[model samples]
Target: MALGVWSPSLIDVVLFVIAAVVVWKLERRRRRGWATGRLPPGSEGLPVVGETLQLIAAYKSENPEPFIDERVRRHGRLFTTHVFGERTVFSADPEFNRMVLGAEDRTVEGSYPSSLSTLLGTHSLVVMKGARHKRMHSLTLARLTSPTAIREAKLLLHIDRLVRRTLDSWASSSLVLLLDEAKKITFELTVKQLVSYDQRKWIESLRREYLLLINGFFSIPFPSFLSFTTYGRALKARRKVEEALKEVIRKRKLEKATTRFDVDVNESQNNKKKKDMLEELLEGEAEGMTDEAVVDFLLSLLVAGYETTSTIMTLAVKFLTDHPRALAQLREEQEGIRKKKKDEEAALDWDEYKSMPFTQCVINETLRVVNIIGGVFRRAKTELHFKGYTIPMGCKVFLSFRAVHLDNEYFDDARTFDPWRWQKNAAAQQVGGPTVYTPFGGGSRLCPGYELARVVISVFLHYLVTRFNWEEAEKDRLVFFPTTRTLKSYPINVRRREEEEGA
Candidate 1:
């Protein structure tokens, strides 16, 4: 309390030094706490790098989550690891998932479909937040939902015709690869239903671009190395889509711009009717973007909407083959539907689809187990405080549930695939719920097409099971193919029933 000239006792100087040290340590803790945790419970790892290398190594063959399992079991649910000069959380906890997704996610900075952002503009749907997300999703639902009546009619006939065509050809080879066949069928149908009026060749070109753009995401971001495969290919494919979309958009603009009818020009329903999502997005402010931006959105949707579904289908079959009893049960259920009269031919109306408890369990179980991608991501939006720890904003957050679902606490015999664990009245397993079971992710901003995926997947499975008989060729040998290049895919073989019956 004395003036500047006054001297302090030796004890006062010692107290000042201790106070300074304490303050420094507290600041350091705040900085450290803001980053996401990389190490999940149980496992041994050195600082900074943790188990990243092990994860990539696991992707080389069967059972990638084991390393993750080792860590989670040893460490417990929450632990830390540093990577690329940052800390991250890799969680499988339902509560943690709920915090990230369902809780308005203001803790997270932003999310995107990731792979789509590099190919499309950053402002595209994958990168949108708040108002933009709501608007775009609404518009997209309108477009996708508009033709539901038409799509439903298309589904029954399209499914039957597709199965028969594929099965009819199955005799050439006793074994059929359901993986490839299902993708092609879905791709063709997705294009037909979604593209609606585009010319076949043009739609094909767009589809090709979508696949290319997707690959760009997983690449090392090394432009010099992959200019030809990733960078150059994305640009060329993007240009093709831009050309086709721009032409249509321009024609529509001219038609709308001029009141007088051009007698020679044939008009599209899209032009006469109110704008579809694509058209609406093209016209909407969408942050003052241009025609190329709109094309990017369409291409991205096809990639996420189509490709993810295809991956799920592949995993579903692989799971079904692994558990024959479950597979048999599914087919038996389908057989009952197959016996229905033509007028009552078992179709899943919205109610029936939602009511399929067993099928819902199958989907959740599949999502819980499938390692379609190695990571889930979000960036911190603001400095968030949890458990007396502060995480600085703009840091990335990830939950690699590969190990969590297999965590014994979450599942009793976690390695085994069991849909019954989720069934009502079961003794009880730790449910991952929406967050930890998040293949579609959590939050209001969760993937809009998830419901659409369930419908498409359920219908596809129903058709495949009831109408065709098939078996795995190298059931055990096949594994999910991992490329440093892109999304996970698998190859499996099957035998067609119709041909066996004919024999």
Candidate 2:
């Protein structure tokens, strides 16, 4: 970098070479230390500008998992990469996953691309680590996820109405734009889940803006200036949505509006008490959860809910379209559930929802096959030694599913789509636990809406599978999600088939 000693052309090459040497030295150090204890194996890849952009670009086609698989193939299980000068490791061992993603590891919780943090902002539980992070989780659990609230959430009229409207509009289309559908559903669901209906327009605008910012993460390369600009616009769009959300909170806290409280209430009363997720956020007993905190909280719920549910839905429909037999089988099973003894229908609440083991299996398998995030992230709380290698305390780590799901040792016929595998062949074992098959991530920071997601998917999918026919659009367009994979527009052929739809 010194001007007198080196010309710019020479400087670029010199700096790169030095970076390569540093990576080689660290890798050798890690590999040599492994004799003292066991360690996972992988590569840091080539050094370039203190980052792995080149490596990622070169390998992104069959990227993420392929990189992990290739590295694991060459380096074994646990391995280190010094790309960007970070001694990062991509480990597949379940125990290692436990060390990084499981609870009690705070040091490695918050190290990610700044763009990621920028996208998540302060409201996200994903980026924050330690007591504050855990506290945020607790605050979420305290009010929004309480048992009674879950039951009441089902009765939310706005959500029910929105879902009905959304579905009704889909009747004419041969192929529904899956991603758009999911965004609409997620935005409506989040608003329905987190805030009031008065701000539906703002919430919608926010969803669009977030989508743009989120899209920039993967489709666009970094430096993030463009993303920041998109984010700035999104911030403006977000302001409109936030205004509506904050207004509800302001109204709730200032007015102490108990008028909206009531079980099995008619529409009039529900409107007055603020029956949205925003209201529940307002109702939290946390000592100092600010309005901005509440706003961030609501925004995260929207993004998380939208990204996961929408992508999964797109994949499920796509998979089912490819595997017609499975689709037919699932339809039969759903029909059977409907024709069950009256007692069974009565029992088919949340408990019965879980009872649909086959349905759950399909969802689980789908997530395993198409995990949206390449891996789960964490940072070292302090310098730690696993096996024998010293992971300089504060080294960021990830337990990638890209490698784990495909590992032949763990999943038999891992590449095949057998929805019944979890129910029949693999029924004895659980797919996701503390460390393995972690699509929603793991530990105290595990996705809070996992259950809600399952429920909505189950119900929404139950309706789709039971009542309509589905097929891929004639042309399959690639959807470019910045940090996520969702359909840009999946035009699936659909048609309603009976008295259930009230023809």
Candidate 3:
């Protein structure tokens, strides 16, 4: 038939459709090849979904390393895969991970999954960029690390009192869920440090909402208006938390204003207490930051200071329990400190807190082995060349701290819980460089509360070893998906040291 004025046969129509499909596929492949240039070697798995399902499944299991280990065997340390709805390169190489973290805002920028970005809010530090990130990060770091903050006498006393009170409550109970209890201790401390609000009922209510918000971070992001999904529930919980925080901010502002005109004697005495982070943010250190921004920032800090730090503390206890020799050594060190104090009931001073060397080893080992924060996500801003391979612009990169931390090449029996390994000078460098052991992340994005975490954990350990004895009440296993945590919240049977001595 003449193409300009003829009817086509069914076979001819079929042939034409086939040809078009072929052309379209070829064009798509050609565009992808050109856009990505030379990517690392790995599979993109199923279309659209990619290997995300596989990643999630592996994470859900007790061991998540197989996902990366299998890939590393086939594709070496650096490989490519599609996950979280984007083509990404997974880097287990220490040098590459270091470069990626250090290159923030230059060649790459901090990124997270759509769910995380939405739940954490647009103004959260993890989603900030350029000068705004630098300013907020610097301000947060300074305030948290300052002598007037963690190291202050009042704050140190507060932390010690809080830790002691928490442990005291546990003395009456024979069985305790360590992870849940640890969360309570850290949550109250964080709330106190942030807003100076420690009403037990209010904090318990806020924490319930916070947990819902956190669970949504790793969920499939469906439109909240469309369905009642985990992410949707998370969005709702976030609103409740934000409203609670905003009310706190409003009262704080009103108090600040009222104090200027009329001050009762008790009010003046109360005002003499040291300023919290919220007070600093409200009084102009974070000038021009909106109420929403302030709330988001505090929300992020709560995640950092509360969830992660509590997990670390719980795991540290777990690790030490699994290795009694380490626990004994740690107890001896802490006891030595206790002997020097004039009053055994007195709070630990800054020097005493800093003096626990072996305790630091336990914390480091826990961080390395458990890797509560398995990895971080960043987006490439420009073509990034590393080790003769080109990372195309706009590609998501995952710096697998878990892979690096668990790799035998980096540490001797890297997966083992050996606190003694950190005994050498330049402990992190004993096996590899500092980049290889980034439990709290690294570079400019390093956790601002790192010191505070160490201090809090150290304080808890001192009281725990010196005051009480505990044993696992039941067997529990670790789960790595969404986040790393114990299956049973690490239940333990406790006995106060005094009762044991009296018996």
lDDT of each: 0.57, 0.63, 0.85
Better of 1 and 3 by TM-score: 3
TM-score to native of every candidate shown: 0.74, 0.79, 0.90
**Model 2 TM-score, all chains together:** 0.79
Per-residue error for 170 in candidate 3, Å, reads 1.4
- Encode model 3's per-residue lDDT on 46-80: one tens digit a residue: 76567999999998887878999999999999999
Error of 3 at 158 (Å): 1.1
Which regions of candidate 2 deviate over 4 angstroms? Answer: 1-51, 58-64, 83-85, 103-107, 145-148, 155-162, 198-200, 216-244, 251-254, 257-276, 283-287, 340-348, 425-435, 477-485, 499-503
Clashes of each: 23, 30, 0
Residue-level error in angstroms, candidate 3, position 223: 1.6
Q: What is every candidate's alpha-carbon RMSD to the true fold?
A: 11.8, 6.4, 7.5
Instruction: Order the candidates by TM-score, highest first.
Output: 3, 2, 1
Candidate 1 TM-score, C-alpha based: 0.74
Worst 10 residues of 1 by lDDT: 480-489
**TM-score leader:** 3
User: After superposing candidate 3, which stretches have Cα over 4 Å from the reference?
Assistant: 1-36, 146-148, 263-274, 425-434, 485-487
Best by lDDT: 3
